[model samples]
Target chain A: MSAFDWLPELLERFKADYVLIHEDAAVTTVGRARVLELDAEDWGRAAGVAAKFNLRWAGGWADQLTDQLGGDKLQINACLLHQGDVLLLRTRVPVTTPVLPSHTLHYPGADRMERHTQDMYGVVFSDHPDPRRWARHHAWGENEYPLRAEFPRMGTRGDMPARTDDNYRFLQAQGAGLYEIPVGPVHAGIIEPGHFRFTAVGEQVLNLEQRLGYVHKGIEKIAVGRDAVGAARLAGRVSGDSTVAFTWAACMAMEQAAGVEVPLRANYLRAIMAERERVANHLGDIGAICNDVGFAFAFYQFSRLREDWQRLSREVFGHRLLMDCVVPGGVARDIDAAAVAQLRAAFAPMKREMRELMPILYDNPSLEDRLITTGFLSESLARLLGATGYVGKASNCDLDARRDLAYSPYDRFKIKVHVFQDGDVLARMRVRADEILISLDLIDELLAGLPNGDVRAEWPMPAAGSEGLGIVEGWRGETLVYVRFAEDGKIARLFARDPSWFTWPALEQLIHGNIVPDFPVCNKSVNGSYSGHDL
Target chain B: MLRLFNKIRKIGVVTEPVMPGRDPAFEEIGEQLHARVGELFSGSLAIREVDAGSCNGCELEVHALNNPYYGIERFGVHFVASPRHADMLLVTGPVSKHMEAALKRTYDATPDPKLVLAMGDCGADGGEFGCSYASCGGVSKVIPVDGVVRGCPPTPLELMKAILALIEKRQGG
Candidate 1:
């Protein structure tokens, strides 16, 4: 065996309570750890005890122990990462009982992460203080945790509970004459359903609270029992707009867990698809953000260009939005040489038009007036809230999983992350607009050095008790997925962390001194995905 | 004003025929949108997006389309903050009862010339969210339906195709 085979011996030497359910000699390393090993599911509690005893793991490897496990090994999953000595424990259990100890005490990242796990899986974090319903507040009822193994397929077969009086107390506004303007759960446009409660004193918003999850689809629970192929299909639908990102992250996680190697060509194609998704969404968001402020011309121009981009995706990649093109182990489809050349041809015109249009948008007085200082968030607030995607960058949070966390081909290419310090609606819009240009440039680079090899790789059957973790930069922000498998490689638990988890709560926080009317413009600036969070 | 002119020039110009709808005013608005926003979004439109107890797939696409990619403006079409501002209601999901009142309010708020466009599989039928008592079936059950764009959540382009078709149908062309 390779040098990593010492992992089993080291676990015993460390006196860690690991049951070594299975171990494979395969290696998967990207500057951290590269060993696929399974242990008794209660390994987290033991690890907690180990941490308490100050049993320092080599290279911060002690934190990866999973305390609780759910879902069948055939579907339930767990993964351990040990690089020179740091241990990271990850599990993918179905939403049933989804009880896991608060890993925040062990790893600070798990703070938002545990909340995310609870949001999608209905997993109860032992003592998560901010336990207010994450993605389920406005969409599904209390009993609907999406990642449970037993969650009925064929679309929630059980009788839904009666609508009871929502006992949630509105955080009382202290000032006199503070009236609440409830905007949605239903709104004026063809927009998603979310409730916005504005505590306004005349035109000034004293506070604004958002209640979302009107569109909870139980995607995680549905993903249980599905094979790697089936899981990617579900992953693509996590949030339809960023299909490629979601599917790629899930595939990356699954491939790592199973110790399967993806072809170089597949990796490049995935990057191309991801860049395309990034461009498409940025184009649309820039236009929509402008439209929110009554900039009809910006809306018209951006949307027209967006429509053209989507048409091109359909022609080159098959599905209009390139849905289901990314599969596990490899992509479901490949871009031919002609398609690559067409994409190259298409970008130049699109880029020229965008260059001309941006100045107009920047120079427009009325649009600037509406966007300038609206919905400002300080740098500290953004970091505390863990904002991802463009919103995070606008607030000066220099983190992009594609760059900082660096996965696969993304690690190979130097990703240009756009950052801003303004942290306002205008900054958010500008960041998104500029990101679109960068994405177009990236696509051109990927096409020029396109990998020449097979695009699909046969994924090996994961040994019983294997697990993995996936994090991808979705259009809205960072989407995290944790997969755990039972002894039979069945999906035991699947937690898909939507960027909306942090962004949604931040929406309420951002609306604080702004007027009620500016809420739509501000909300559109972030555009968090409720479905991605809900599942 | 120069910015406006330049933006217009960048969009290029489209000269397509407008279609007539049940109402002349909507038809007229559609014609104006055709001249201004181009034919892709020119017409009286109603939108019915089902929530099909969704994970909110269709909603993001719908939101993105409205935001920048396919900003449903420049054509005189706007995502009326209320159904009253709308001529067509676009529905997205599997139609959950929780969304029923809001959907009805949105649809009823629209005056006439309102065409209902079922956005995703959830709206056309129940999609994956169908068959639950929590779900209210399709958009037609709640309001009059004019067109359907099917997929788990039809891509933004597919949605554009349906909206364009509605514009043509409104012109009776």
Candidate 2:
């Protein structure tokens, strides 16, 4: 039986009657996700049903409806996933009194998202557990909502005072033994900045509150008025490590919105790029995690391997990171038979080296001692936070978008989704290792059976007000994008929700019992994208 | 432990030479800087990196300098945790408004005789996320920069060369 087979019946049983809007249903169907429009009053009730059905709260974003219909209504979108199917729940609230019932009471994952929406669009989610400003910093005033239509893309300059971050009220732990350890908005390492306040007693963390809008580059605001291709470029930079994934997701959204079909060969190439990106990141991450645990040998070896892997990517795809490779309607570059042969030849040596190194890492007593049971995030906590990707997979929440959703060329490949119930640092490491091996095999298969045809298709402009959703299993996890085009063939509103949104909160949960020293290893194990989350 | 030794034996030496050959222009510039500044940095250069608002692309490339191939530490270059210990500030990203004050504070905290190297196009001049309501643009807007390395994300070799140039600048050359 399918996982979402009971979704229709469950929706019908909801107290609030929802009207399914199918105006752009064709575009929505491109992602194989169902879209439903409901009354604002029923939003919370519908969310409750989703939670009751054990659906994963994917992400939520707010889109201003001023361009489509010159009014004060703001369209709020929430995505829920059960097995393979994505159920997008949307509701509209007036701009004057932009208040809606919060879904955080049912699904705690919606807390940060609702706060983000509040910051960006001024849509208040009444009864949200933590109603703190999420994505907003001192850059924009409380009165100004950047994502709203009236707000200029460049924004009102110098309207607010500098350095307003000092006033943020971190949840304090008041006790004799309790003391707060504030770590960065500027960190020691060569990393993106995000402040972490750990309320700890005797080296055990009581509460960990994160302040992460330091890298917010106004991505959503800049995406507006950009053409489909321009938007894809913007999306590629949303998270640098997940460039191919973000670009692919953005392109997929744009193509779906414009009613364009990418060629089969292009789809296959995209998979190859995505897999390469995955391998590159996993190798780096595995090394970084080991480094955090004082395993320098593995760090050196894995970093070398990753460097060699990225060099091959540069040779084949032209960019070291494969940025701008996935464009609207198709890919920006294509590989020849020689390049294919090169990739196939390269994998065997890599696989052999990886196999040789795995035992050394797994068998190392000191490393295992550091990693094994450290940073334990219970399965219940992982589920509650709506964690996906390696973090979720480690906690036994087995959902892989590539295997479950199986979009295009991925449907042809037999993908293995690895799950470990340990919910610890070692489990996360094991997942990354297993994924690396699986991804290598998949890439080999993809290249071996690559279809021969044209790579690109001409994109036709769809009517204004058309919307499309693109979901891709990025290296980190599920990357969901929603795109709506304007009358001038520009993007009206584009929201790219990275998997870090779900996983970052999981980091805070996992670090509770562990000592302060273990925090780095635990953080590396999860490796949440700060820029991606901030955007 | 025996298996670990065997594995190490199989992998062999992966480290490469730091400077295989220097670019002619770089060599000339190096000499000019060396002549201009006489051993301002006699021993080692310590760096502190700040991400203003990058996509983390440039940071990744910067990190590659520590890997086996580059081994920047061998060249008397190291990343320090505190700005006070740092001889250079390797700043990345288009400076975001939120990070503007933080970047300034970091720059101010760094001791004098500090060389500020803005890495990546975003650091030199706001690449994609330019001057806007949310961003103040490049590193120079928030803090004065001595050198700029250009690329969407400048390659590791490019970064090494830029670092070398900064080293010369620090030496009063």
Candidate 3:
């Protein structure tokens, strides 16, 4: 028996409602009972049963739960943890007021995530501290939950009141010599929209609070009625930077729920695409980080390098970003022999050049001066806040979804994770650069051992009550997606969790004591995706 | 002398003319940029990137271009972080309603004679999100675009090709 076989006993310890337990095909629970049967009501009740275990049963039953679990279960949601396991929760209320308890009180990581759910889905969390609207930063008015079923798709609320003027409350910066510097909804560089409110004493930063959602695309609401293909398209666009990860996670969840097996070749190609995404991002970030410290040569060289890298992507993936390349069952297209040959020919010189440039970057005194101590995040804080990607790895969060949650080929390959104790901008930069090198190596391995098989498999219709979970270590961090299908194989409900939702809050913490000017560098060091979170 | 010392000591990529769309006192800036652009054609590059306002589609191949095995950086191009440091801007997506000012600011902050390449269909013509209420459409609406890397977030190689073209253009090739 698997370690989870004793779950019923663990639930008994908590006095959770033993609604029903399915004993036949993998033991399952519903409401307060544990039984062995395939029934929709049992699944629905299992959701309610989570409440007895401290989970709030607020929203409607869907394929997965990415929203708030309000009412009494809020505290439970915060603190619950399972080893080598995944949880998919969905709620449905006939009344307009759907209540799910706050989980932030139990799980500190869920603090910001729940607030976002409350704002987007209109789920009310009673007594949840910092109940300030998270995603609706004046983009929507009071009670205007964008993700709700009733919100009209194409309607204009002319002259929506400014969020800062009325809704978004900034902590007062008081005392003589302490002042506030409000920078960007509009910034000076090619970046996303996020307003930073800095409270500073001269050059040193005292506190920095970020107000994002300026680019909210209402992606979750649009996914409500979408088919699997439609939803896959939307998922890839959730954060343009990490499209490969998001789409892969979404497809993984769907295929699992539908009991469809993706071909081995497709999985290999997916890994290749994901590694490419990782390389491109790491290259740009390392270059940008150096430039922030007044190192222009590394910045320009890296930028030029990144552009060439992307140009070659067109030849292989068809789209530079490889958007929509991943779909349910398999990938949209295949890589040709010429493309493979081009890649093999190209990698050698690129690696050599980076090697030559590395010493120049490390040997430079000023480059080290700027990156070494700026924007330090203690390893402990990194863990607590759940920072992912290079940010967390640099800070000693020794977790990569490729290894931690072994799926297929990842289990076969040994993934090297570069970690640092310093957890500063420099550490993050080092980790990114190292990871880029490693990803290149892995890509070579994957290409050399290219498998021959069908890219896709026939998708089976999921039983009405079937549900599954998918968690991927996106270039940013761990991305979670859950899918629940109706009896007819259509989507019943879907939810996606981006790593940025966790890392953005960490930004506020890392900026403490950093100089006001250094804030941009620190932010660039982390480089969280706003679109990924807003969706 | 110290100011000059500070400028000369910096070690990321430095192209000719520290500021694009602006004039410089030293003729060396132009000459420096020409030499660097020439090097890019001869060598491979790796890029560190930042997204200003994009539908995110541009970000797709911006990444896909380097997937293992493709190794676009092997071609002598790379994405860098700081504006004071980068050789070019591979901006994807149309500038959005909220990102207009940020887009221009990023452009202005970039060092001189820098190539501002617009990637993807949206970066060129706003794509699907261009006409939407949230988007300002093409980034060129806010900043000068040197190279238009077309396609709906053009294929990685297409983006790579466009950047290669930018390097050649800057070198006056």
Candidate 4:
């Protein structure tokens, strides 16, 4: 079904076009993710080939190769999703003339990822469309690259603060009755900061442009000296709401790098906590979306449910958001009988309230009037944008890491991924509602079959130059983490790709032709993470 | 409409008992933040929340303050959209350098005789992510802070306690 039989042979033929320096597809404990090296000249062509093979573009990042030799080389890496596996393409370029062909021409989602790599590592994409500064809003000087090994972690800043929000150009659309509405970096409500510039004719938006990186707290730069546990804590902070998944991803990367087999019980507990997180966020989002449409009752009810659910998480796992719950070797705490019983009993009331409210949510004609056709993201567009979570599901892009790339815990579980065709606000909300029930069921089954064994294994410090990648389905969408260890097993570099990276661009596309006021509910339905995206 | 009413009645009176009460787990929140910004926001406080650059953890708890369980609105604390209408600014950070001018503009916009209370450990002293090229490190570095409610993010109850504590300290209690 995959039709990847031609992959190996096709790769072999590429040796004639450009030099094939190195190639290996390592089957690590995590899974098989094929890695290959290509000459820097044909970097864009490789992306085209991957696109031709129908591989989903995962993410793109760069590693500054500070070899023992005097050669100053930077290795550019791009990951593509291939049926429960990943094909990583790496190409090397000298730091002086760090330019490669663009991948954005093939996949629209690669636009920001490539820009981020450029902003951080000073890698240049020659044919990049709309090449603006991303993640570099006066964070450093124009020539200074923070991700470079020589650059200070605190940045090259002095006593006074540099002006950060000026001198940037935004695209202009001139027409009759066209006016721009600028929102955020600092928003009206309790949310993270990111600037959105919109050009609209009266109420209908003509174009939407976003300038983010206001929250780029130097996550990658700061992770330089931290060990595995410390790295996990920092990863947890990458996105506050999806702390469990981020922490798990970081820890899983470390575990795989160290070649340690996590205890079966720990993996089970990890799945349970991840599901709980999914449920909590979904409940909060559904309520928020309803509230956005002026349905105050649903917001109040859902808030109560979420608050209650999170309190249990804080009680059982020692933090409301479940940060630091998943450690390098295993989970921080084990579930005692009382905690397990309480958790088992917690779902019934939640499910009952949800059952009563969902029909009301779907049946309301007034709410439906606003939701049924607003913010329609077509199926082909979702795939092009590499959208995931409810945003993708609503558009009938039925891809879920839990099912498609099934790992431990999820490997045994039967995952029901719901997809819809309308691609409107209503479809997105319905997907969230459906997914909450599915996650609840998953958590229920996991708790019922709680494994009895040691919850942790010894995680020895991995050798220098060890690297691994970890991925999990975060509440927002697919969360990917890449970590490389340095001397004394300290983190040399870490790149985290939040689902928001894909969904943010998708937001820009979906907002086209929608009224200005409907933006909030549509945005709530998608709920992209700002802190996660900024980092 | 009748069906909606029936559903509402069936799930009746779900508003949480006001205030963030003590939980079974975690240490009791006994620490009271000290601040003296004079007697302002006496019977009511209009808060303008500025995220200079937070992990959004503090914002989550701040939002929880409005939830039925910890309904601070019942106690006369409300979140205002515009800074000019607010009596206090609840800012969260490691204040990113990119946000400095915006935060300054927000602070300048707020009418005088206002209190600025930094939220979270990051706001208190930059937490784990200290001063960097990207970050100015701590909210006080960017704007004057009257008091702080500390935690990676303080719970909704803890935030409520801190807000009340700020009022008490300011009113010379």
Best by DockQ: 2
lDDT of 2 at A125: 87
TM-score of each: 0.76, 0.95, 0.74, 0.95
User: Which regions of candidate 4 fall more than 4 Å away from where they truly are?
Assistant: A1-6, A9-31, B18-42
Query: What is the fnat of candidate 4?
Result: 0.71
For model 1, how does the per-residue alpha-carbon lDDT over B73-136 read when each residue is reduced to its tens digit? 5455555555655567777766665566566666676787577888787788876545443455
Best by lDDT: 2
Evaluate chain B of model 1: give its TM-score: 0.67
Per-residue lDDT over B24-96 for candidate 2, one digit per residue giving the tens place of the 0 to 100 score: 5434443443343344555466889999899999989988889887676765677999998988899998888
Instruction: Extract clashing residue pairs from model 4.
Output: none
Clashing pairs in 2: B33-B173, B34-B173, B37-B172, B37-B173, B40-B171
Q: Over the true interface residues, superposed, what is the Cα RMSD of model 4?
A: 1.3
Q: Interface RMSD, all models, one decimal each? A: 5.1, 1.3, 8.1, 1.3
Per-residue lDDT tens digits for candidate 3, residues A157-214, read 5423233323478888789899999876645554666788999999999999888766
Model 1 docking category? acceptable
Model 3: residues with Cα > 4 Å off, grouped in runs: A1-13, A16-83, A88-95, A155-167, A459-467, A486-492, B1-53, B57-150, B154-173
